[model samples]
Every structure is written in C-alpha cells, then in structure tokens.
Target: MFIVSLIFFVLFLPSVSVSYANTLFLHIEGKNDTLSIYAETGTQTKSYQVKRLQDIEALYPLLQRRQIDRNSFEQLLRELGIEVFEPIHTFIESSSEIGFVMAENLVKLPLDLLYVKEIPLFLQKPITYSFTKINSQNLQFSNTLSALIISDKTADPENGTYFLKKLLPSSAEYYDIKDINLTQLESIQTKDVILISAHGRIRFDNNDCIGLGDEQISPSHLARLSPKLVYLDSC
Candidate 1:
C-alpha cells in the first residue's frame, strides 16, 4: 500500500506544480482608474481593446508571413485587434519555451506601450532635431558664432542658468540678457549668431518668421535687430 501511494503522489505532483506556475495576474493603471487582465497556460481571461484598428489590420499579413504560433498570434490579435484567417496550428507548429517563460514571469501587463508604439506622436515628428557637439569641428566655428540668452528671473531660473552654462563656452563669446533693455541691445555691436533663449512669439510675413517678445519686446522691437542666424528657444 505504501509503495502504491508513493507512485501516485509523484504522478500528481507535476500537474499540481504546473497548474500554480501557469497562472499569471497583471495590473494596469490608466488615467482615471485601474484594470486587470489574467491568463492561463494557453489562454487569456480578458479581451484587449484596440484604439487604432486599421494600422494593426494592415500589419496582420506581415505577422502571418513570419509564421508565429496560434496562442501568440491570437494574443497579438486580441491586443492589436487584427484578424488572421490561418489556423493557429498551421502557423505555429510548436510553442516556444522562451515565450512561455516571458509570459509566466511578466508581473505587469504591457500598459499601452504595445498598442501606442509611438508616444506624443506629434512631438516625434518635429521638422528638425539635432544636437551640437563640443569638439574640433565646433572649435573652428566657435569664434564666428555668438549666442544671446534672454531670461527673466521668474519664468525658469534653473533652465536659464543651465543654458547659460552650456552656451557660454570657454572658446565662444556669448551674452545673457537678464533684462532686455535698449542699452543692452546697443552693447552688442558686431554679432554673428544671435540666440534668443526666452519665451516669445514669431510672426511670418513673406518668407521670414519674425520673433516677438512677450510683454518685454513686441514684434516692432524684434524687427530692429538684424542678425545672420537668430535662434528663438522659446515659443
């Protein structure tokens, strides 16, 4: 009787372990409230709601072409809300251990990251985004370049101070405007590059975007100063 009982316990032990291991619980926090999604060993407890269905549908053929498994493909479909005609068994012959491991270990459900692949989509599509490197190429042009940083003590003191440090290099001659006065403008005589790092609005007439200062310098005032390159850091 003892030997029979031992064999039975060993046979049931693996199933019990797998049952506990396969269960995955996830919590997701949204703007107003929180939500949860649970999944078992080859199935999901809840369905995923997709905002942009068209883009995901367009990409379905590509996923099928790659021959991903039924569970994974279905999971992707549910999350992305795209339909696939092919059977799960035909597409994915064998399930991946790596995929299972990843799914089992995932404590946090991917919150909008998978669906909203690009964040602040507008910000990412800027016309130009480039950084200046402080090296040999920059050194040769430092003397020819001059910067003007405008700052009021109230708006952004830390950012103004930080920009002042970055723009005021040892090799370059730069100016910081604590107060925008007519005398201050008069002091800068032969400046090549004029960087207006302050909050301002710009107006376009023919082909040029004219810079207008807020409360301090109007559109009429900015029209007076003439510089080859004018960089307005503020909007």
Candidate 2:
C-alpha cells in the first residue's frame, strides 16, 4: 500500500528590496506501508519507491525506552532504501541544510544522525530546514534572535538543554521546566526559536503530548505557538 503527499511554500528572501522568487525542493517520508517522495525544481517533478518496514509502531516504543538496537534500525533503513530515496540526502542540496520534524518516538532514532550505508547523513549534508522555514517570515531583515528551552530533567536525564545550548547561538536564552508553565507558554513570545527537551507520548486519540516543567501539554496547547523554529526532541 502507498500514498503520496506534496506540500509547497513560496519562500521570500529579503534584500534592499523584497522579492518573491525562490527555488523549489522536496520532502520525503516512509511511514508504515507508504513510501513517498515529492520533488519539484521549478519545472521538474518525479516520484520514487521503496519497500516499507514492518512493526514500525512496535519499534517506536523501543525507541522511546532507548532500547532499540542500531544494527536492527539500520537494517530497517536498508529495507526502506534510504539510498533509493536520494532526495532525503539532497533535498537541501542548493542550501546545504536539512531541517527535520519528528514525533517523540522517532526522535530516538533521529534520521539526521543515522548512518546510511556507512555514510552518516549529517556528514553528507547539513540540516537547516527548521531554521530556514521557521524563520522565513520573521528574520529575513532582522538582527536579533532569541530562544526558549523548556526541559524536565527528571523525566529526561539526557540533558537535552546542554546539547541544545551547544546547537543554538550563544545569545539564545535558556529556561528549565521550573521556569515555564501553560500561562507563560501562552503569553511568552519566542521571537526566534523554541526547543522542548522532555518526555513525550502519543495519546490513544492520536494527540502528541509533551511533559513540560510543571504540566503536561497536548497538541492543542502547542497549536497556538508561532515560533520561527520549534525542535521537539522528546517522546
């Protein structure tokens, strides 16, 4: 079984004068029975195929528990034909960056950090999609950037805050779980970035929920956020 989906955005770049012209690219994902690739470079378009892996839903929980075996996961990637889906490697060929969005379980085996046939995807190309797309509208002509990090060390001892600090600019601000809440989340305006490093789970109803500092937040709570970039590194 297979289904394909394609999404487009006309990103604008700012100079002394603003222009609407931009390049086109593709995004691909193989979730369960479907392997989808959407490509467009202004005029060209194509589709590719790969066999989907089984027991993906089962594997996700192992990932959440951090008990997944790399050898097995890589084998799954091989069956899924990461090499065949070359677009995954070159989607940001022009800009040399890739931005990723993943559910909490998938975060355990982050594709960007995996090895595809001996080549680490990170080494093949940079991942910048989040920074590029999220800030596309707000930071084109701005000089200032800010970040808010909400993490619960008790729930996640991975020290996501430490790693995020290393990834984000030194100018970015930091906040522990104790410093954030639903009220603050609703009112605080994250001008540049929002990173959540905590435990997450998918509800029976298919809603993605995150364990924040003082309270648990559901997808509905996050729907109102408008940060230029959001990195949910949990689940």
**lDDT at residue 135 of model 1 (Cα atoms):** 14
Query: Highest lDDT, which number?
Result: 2
| Residue 35 of model 1, lDDT score | 26
- Give the Cα lDDT of each candidate: 0.32, 0.50
Q: Give the residue spans of candidate 1 off by over 4 A.
A: 1-122, 125-144, 160-177, 202-215, 218-226
lDDT value, residue 209 of candidate 2: 71
Clashing pairs in 1: none
lDDT tens string, model 1, 105-190? 22122222132122311122211111210111111334435545555433335655345437556523343454456556656554
Q: Which ten contiguous residues of candidate 1 have the minimum total lDDT?
A: 1-10
Candidate 2: residue pairs that collide: 98-127, 98-128, 98-129, 99-129
